[model samples]
Target: MSETRIVGLRTERGWTQERLAEVSGVTVRTVQRLEAGNDVSLDTLSRLAGALEVPLRDLVAERAERDDTGNAGSTDDIDDTGGPAAGDDAAARHFADAARSAWRDIALGVALLVTSPAPVVLLIAGADAGLVPTSVEVAIAIGLGALLAIALVATLHLVRASGRLSPFLPIRQERVRFGARALRWAERLEGVHRRQRTRATAVACAMWVSSPLPLIVVALIEPGRGQGLWIAAATAVLLVVVAAGAFTALRTAWAPYVQAKLAPAVEARATV
Candidate 1:
């Protein structure tokens, strides 16, 4: 069976595999397998296509074209190890720079979003614990102010990042021709990112599962006054831990995620 444009289509809309699965009513693993070029039933394909709002034929046809071009006997643009040739060094650099910028902005924005509530949480908790000489209403007002400011900053940053990728968006959406060299570069980039993502995700999962432990321990050990402060502190710590993990994972994954969407572009040219 021919491959599908699930990855490109999904990414074009800025949707993750989990998001796509949720919208399409399928398992995340199934979406992963499908994007990995595994075979699937027509019903499954139809469901995914419907969710992506694209005709099923377009998805299958797009990949078929790419497969054909990739299978063609063309090694002039490839090195001995099947990597991008010297001729493509400039193109690779340009693509890498753009991809890196977009990745950096997106990761930083996500980090901001996750950590945005930390200040507010800490402030409110501290006020409640009497550590800060402020009324609860005043604390809430200040916290909300901080939260809104951070949220606005993050929103603007992400929007700018998305705008910066306008040139590459077509390639990502598979609307333009992409060469084999770019595909190889994307594959290599993805391989490196995969390792980093694995480590970060594992760490994040561990942190998340243990986040509540601190609060639990504090509550159990101290059943008297000032316990609220400790509990609030623990909650603040929990948010920070979650933020760090999320930031690390997303930071490591962004470039590859964006580039991977371009990997399936039809390799009809000698260079990107």
Candidate 2:
């Protein structure tokens, strides 16, 4: 009922929510809400306390604050001053940034699954032959499903790698206007705008480059005397264009030309 226990325990140990979450097997979001005394589940509190290297009873203990009746209010009602020591705003920010990156990863992964040659091919090809899947159509469906599975795993893992040490390293912005908030509201909002543009632009651009996938697939599926060579040649050209775009995405130079979008499929992972 009171976060004073959580706060007092955290302050005593000097652990950030991120650190706490790491040890607890609980998500940063859950740790955050618990620290606010939001009536979280017992399992969640057990994890949070474990992450803080404290007992659940210790985390639930009352702090110095007390009402006239000698009863303490809900910990969520406490001021920031009563929170973690050093008030580690940077730690809070990092948690938020990590969350933002996670959601972004999911968005991009979904987009990749949608845009990947496999699924796009099935949707475009299958709809034409009607929903009744044939043997060959079923095979195509299986491949498409596999693409989505791979994309999902990549997105989920890369979500953990958005820190300064992350591969898709963030630009240093100590004084930048855009930043994560303790509440994470602004982060989610901004991430949404960026993701929407990222998908729209990547799809529009990929559309131009993806024209050859079907052609290449056709050539491979029904290789004739020289069809494969023709398809391969066209694929090579598309690859060149894609490579250039990829470089631009890496350099963030494409941030403008593609309506301020990075490549949807490529992920930057943090080594840590």
Candidate 3:
């Protein structure tokens, strides 16, 4: 492919040479050389086109046309069908679904962590008001503790499952189909930054931490007081805000990854 076409495509996507190199599995030096119109091997060209989400022939043909006519072709002449091979579309769909499911799993974990204290709080309140016997409260606490333990286990398992996938490792078909879809999706996704995953995890933790604050505030305020309703209303508002913030943050962090991961498959399908 012509260096100008490669450079144009990369710049149009706002990709730096380093970013392109990382996504294309090439060295930064190689990217620089290619951009400078140095000859690149067929394999290298193929990688670049894949990473840039364009057809290989389009790059080669555009370069050939430019050389023959002594005029660089228009950007519109380059085919933008940078998509995965046809056979990969099914795998891509599965990975996308898995990524989405993993997010839900994480959300469920956060919900469990956030709500874990509710039973205990209720038990304490009931005992203080002489509405519950000591024996019953003890039993309830034990049950809730067990439930919390189970929730924690499930949460950790999900987190581990969603951890980063290693591209060098051979992934089993069953795993791709049934487990760790998040990792699979990440492996397939181009241009996913570590910061995005970190931010998403942080936001989820923050949501869990903040979720109980409203209930704690309500507990500190006397329910027998005339302001109980006001306290409840305020708590509801706070919970809503926390939920909304978590939703927005998680979506912001993961949406790009998902879109990038699926772009090739989507484009392939479109071309068909």
Candidate number of the best TM-score: 1
lDDT of 1 by residue, 51-74 (tens): 776644555665445555785333
Q: Please, what are the lDDT tens digits per residue for candidate 2 over residues 1-272?
A: 56666766667778887876776666888778877767665335434543554543444456434543468554432233322211123433443444454545444444443334444344434444454355555656765677667666656645543331121221121111121232244334445556655765575577557756756665657665545344544554554445434432333222231211111101111110
Better of 1 and 3 by TM-score: 1
Note the Cα lDDT for every prediction shown: 0.66, 0.45, 0.55
Off by over 4 Å in 1: 1-93, 267-272
**In candidate 1, what residue range of length 10 has the lowest lDDT sum?**
78-87
Q: All predictions: root-mean-square deviation over Cα? A: 14.1, 13.5, 15.1
How does each model score on TM-score?
0.60, 0.33, 0.36
Where in model 2 is the C-alpha error above 4 Å? 1-61, 64-77, 80-88, 116-138, 144-148, 151-272
Superposing every Cα of model 2 onto the true structure, what RMSD results? Answer: 13.5
Q: RMSD of candidate 1 to the true fold?
A: 14.1
lDDT of 3 by residue, 22-76 (tens): 9877799999998887766544654576577665555556565775576854433
Clashing pairs in 1: none
* Position 166, candidate 1: lDDT: 47
